[model samples]
Target: MSYFDLSKFPPSSAASDDGSVSSLLSISPRSSRSIILDQSFFDAEDPSPSPRGLAEPPPQRSLPAINDALYSVQVNNRRRSTNSNTTTSVSSNYDSDSSGRSGRRPIKTGEMGTSSERESDGEVRYQEKKSKPKPKKKVSVVISGGDKVKRNGGIRMAPLNVPIKRRLQTAAVLLHGFTIPLYTSLFWFLLAIPLTWPILIPYLIYCLFSEAHFDGSAPRRRSHFLRSLPVWRLYTGYFPLKLHATTSLDPAKNYIFTYHPHGIISHGAFGHFCTENTTGFEGLFPGITNTLLTLDSNFRVPFYRDFLMFMGLASVSRRSCEALLRGEAAQPPPTWSAWKPWTWWRLVFLLPIFHPAPHYTAPTGGGRAITIVLGGARESLEAIPGRMALVVKRRRGVLRIAIRENAGIVPVLSFGENELYDQMVPTGGGMIEKLQMFVKSVAGFTVPLFHARGVFNYDVGLLPYRKEVNTVVGRPVFPKAQMESPRDGDLDEFQERYLAELRRLWDEHKDVYAKGRLPGKEGEMVFVG
Candidate 1:
């Protein structure tokens, strides 16, 4: 996988929403002490005297100037009282610059006064439209170690004035969003109690025989209704998730979406693909049934297995991959899956039966999509917020599969995935790293040492940090026609193209989608084996 490091970079210097402004802001803890700014600090009023030999430090290093800037919004806002802290707080620096945007032009006083009116009988009446002065730019300043966050406004959606009931409902939604993953184990653990054994035994018996563990195509599992529920919308919306498409896909084709840098969990993939009515995936790209693929191990989880199926999730395994993409229970070529032995009867059964997905069902189905979290567990170790690192150079499994299935590859990047949690990456080759590696070898996944703001506080919780996550879906890269035994070099070539597209997407939109991700340097997407 790739590598990541924690940044000492502060949030105040982050980019403005829409990237219209690039001012560096320093947000310190809210001090009760009144900030003092000397008149000489103003660059326009009194330029500081230059030293004989040494150059001056930049304006950023000057505390008085920072204070003056932090408190200068009072005059700009036309507040009568500059003494009131509310008028000049640092948060006001984040206000939306709507007047500067196109189309919605604010009226200017000069233009208003220029309009003249004529009256009958040589009596002329002048008419002037009153116009409000444009508001200054504002940005939300999240001060560390203090609850006194001055969120005056910038770069985020405007908060709604909801009733108390709605506020409580939102809280409930957040709580549910966070707890749903853990609830699976919790459900079984409760059922394990002696009094509940009767119900638990039958469920266990049913689960033991269920093909839901291996076959995602099972009719009962993929419930379109459950995927359409309001709860799923709340779950996805808790991140206030956004789904963007670089371009629409053709309904006649199948696609393979490879999601990068699997942050803690591929929550973005789930929010974007697994639910349709909520994230509006269907409305955006109609006629495509998208399956968000995951490690088969998740299908082994109690209660959670069923939920994954209901959400149209399937195993990201060799047999499962071939079946979903090609619409047949075809065992991947021996080169793809070295272990599974093949039989001719299985091939024979599929010769006359399959249609390729009709609504896009196999045989008559519209075409289908299979999304894989390309970076998997190893990459999660590198999932530090604000840094973009990917483990894609050696990620040829999905590419090979896509080539074999003739599925177009679509690169999906979640701009704020890593921001959901702060991870603790043990030093390379250190004991902790070795232990994590050992666990992954035996158990198929490694746990990253990670944490996020709690439900109660902003620093210790299982709930994902309440940062906006924008997932941009790029145009598809159509793989060469079906190759039963695709060449390794050809697969690598496709991967290079895929990686290039991902980098292109990042390079193009980082300013907007991942603004303030890295300061001083442009954010880089690294590819380590």
Candidate 2:
């Protein structure tokens, strides 16, 4: 809509020879910036993940600040009476014809043309500063007696030590955190019953053929409402997980994040990478879409399958990994597709020998990343609170996938992961350890005989302890001079370089991140695969 002054036309500034008078025209200076910037607009629908709901600190910009701010001239559109009916330049506010909010009617882009064009159009020259909004001050109040009272505060969050309100909130969150695992376990039991076969059979068959589970169908994971549920925030506050980037990762490159020391459930990986809402990971590493990979066996279960998928969990199995890397319809599991239905049982029996189910294998457009708890179940055996023991020593599963996919690797070291649970791992040959190993050997996964503090007390439950878990993502290690089917020597060389990088990362910050660990030496680590 074009804006103009509404007033009786003033008499012509000059008379014509025929004694006829013309209305005087008023002109003003105004900037039409929108028209200038219109041709430079670009499409911003990039696939890169953007930051959402994160309270990140302001970035440290390297560019020098501008010394002066320049603003374009605008216009005041109200009309007024002048002593003479002549062309005149004016720079004063005029009354509005409406209910009267008194402010200059700023010039808008596209409203008028060039200065000469505007002069011909009878516009007035106006000079005014651009309007600026006033900054609002944030006030903090201590909630005592329900009356607001200002309090001085520092950059740190309030301590969660003894506040009754905060404690109650924590208790609720602890309960909510249990809901997922409890429901998944419960679904496994309920769905396995013969009575539920009619429903279970159909769903399982559907999952068998459907590609959604592995085709990057991640709408659910991106749901801000679900991902940012207060429960996760509480879960985060419970151990109070923190994610760090030792070096920034380029969004233009794909990555395989190999997480170490898969303590118990690999809770560190879940809190940091599984949910973008939980950690504001995009704020830390913008444009990288990180999906946490889990056992394909997890997806074989009924409700549990959907639950994991909703949380953006993908199968770590070979074909599943390959499918994700290629971003195509998932190729069916080898045994399932290759073996006869009558031979399925025997195929399951031979699974361990044929396929190490929980492992992943990459792409272009280059924004994808998968978080692999590289230690798998073996690391759970070495999980000792306050100590750094990883089964990554001989674990080349991730490297194998990395080499095949040619994806860069990053070692993700999550300190204090083991401290969250106290696992009861007896010596190697004990009956209990034997049973655990048997389960792992047959089923490909073993539940750690672990415990953490309960909601009501400081002992005996599945809840992780209230310790600080800092996950630092080390620098990317790109394998150089590699072949599609990499040689063993080449793989070893890359692994050695990766190990050095992992060590460098730990040695550089272990003192700070593992600060409150049980008074251990700097390099007392158990890194076995």
Candidate 3:
């Protein structure tokens, strides 16, 4: 066998090879004699100087020819030194023993050296370890009862959700439709029988006689006995409105207020002009009694007629308009000693009845005025929630009314009125549009398929949503009074001036209330007949 030199192997492999040899020798390297033998008998420990001198190499130690040969020599040398040291320790131990029982004891092998036995032991160990099982990991407990567990383990209960304003609005709507008419009829009936029957009875007889016998075109004295009903009060209180006057309205002068974008039903007109709900109208412009004109057909409704008349709501017919504007002021009863009278009662009795003649006349010396809703039914259909698009094409009728009456046309712009109800289907055009027009034409007002909220729930009902309505009364447009029919050019000029004033009103105050809306459409005015 070729003897191998020890220095050519890597350090880790050489050390491992020595460990295997000690297992074959049946001696533990940990013994004292093994330590001594390793220190004194290894090749590195040979102390003799080289034959050439202390620094000279050995003369004929040839380099190993093959790589394996070099590795084998290194491994063999390491094993020889380790085995020799372990054997010395074992022999010394045997000599020192008093009882010779070494042959009877089992030979101990190192863990790494005995492969088959370790494999068998590993199988047994793995089986035993597998059978023993791992302990379970702890899981967090969530004790859910009344306390709700938040994602982070905190507890909270849900909050209550309710709409209080919607309930109030529903109450208002119910009061307007049901309770108001009942109360007004009772109050008016009591007053007519007890005190005013004599005057009212004669006036009605004269009105019937004149309307039937004479040329119904003749002028007549209008009564004020039943015009102070609480229904109007209830109607006005339903909205948040403020009446601001740029200039004092002269009571002696006749006037016309042309309300624009006639919302749903001219609710703003009913609240602002016909009723004294916003501010004390009698106090604001003393002696100035205003009437909200409606379609003439409204006077044909059974109970609604009396209720409307009691609230100072008259027909917009030519006869009704003239009669309301030219009627005489009510004279106070002679004698101041009757006991201090109720101011509201006295005003109700004494305020002038504005009954102008059936022919639309320029104000007497130019003072009489009439108010018409410029947008009419068509614009009411265009009142979409959160946006306004006026439908006023060929709407020079209001200009004509202003010019013919010589009444300074005051344009009233109502913001937030469109937001009151959410229309169910989109409005503009289609089958529904045609149907809406047909119904409006026949019934005098179209019922928009709209929903707001129930008194408690947000899902369904006829009550309007509790949106704030701010009706802005724009600056008055005083067109040049013409004696004869207004010429085509003059009518065009009046329309332009009126439109400009309306646009200015919207620009000045739209931001104050309608801040969330897209900017008013550029030149978006749509004129209608």
Query: Please, what are the lDDT tens digits per residue for candidate 3 over residues 56-153?
Result: 33223333323243344345545654777732111111111135322112223451236355334321110001134689653433321221222222
| Full-model lDDT, candidate 2 | 0.61
- TM per candidate comes to 0.61, 0.59, 0.53
Provide the lDDT at 454 for model 3.
Answer: 47
What lDDT does each candidate get? 0.61, 0.61, 0.50
The per-candidate count of clashes, in order, stands at 26, 15, 29
Tell me each candidate's RMSD, in Å, in order. 25.4, 28.4, 21.3
lDDT of 1 by residue, 254-347 (tens): 8888887699877788778877677778888887767788877776665666566656678888777767765552222223232322222123
Tell how far residue 282 is off in model 3, in angstroms.
3.7
Against the true structure, candidate 3 reaches a TM-score of 0.53
Q: Which stretches of candidate 3 lie over 4 Å from their true place?
A: 1-170, 178-237, 328-369, 425-429, 519-529
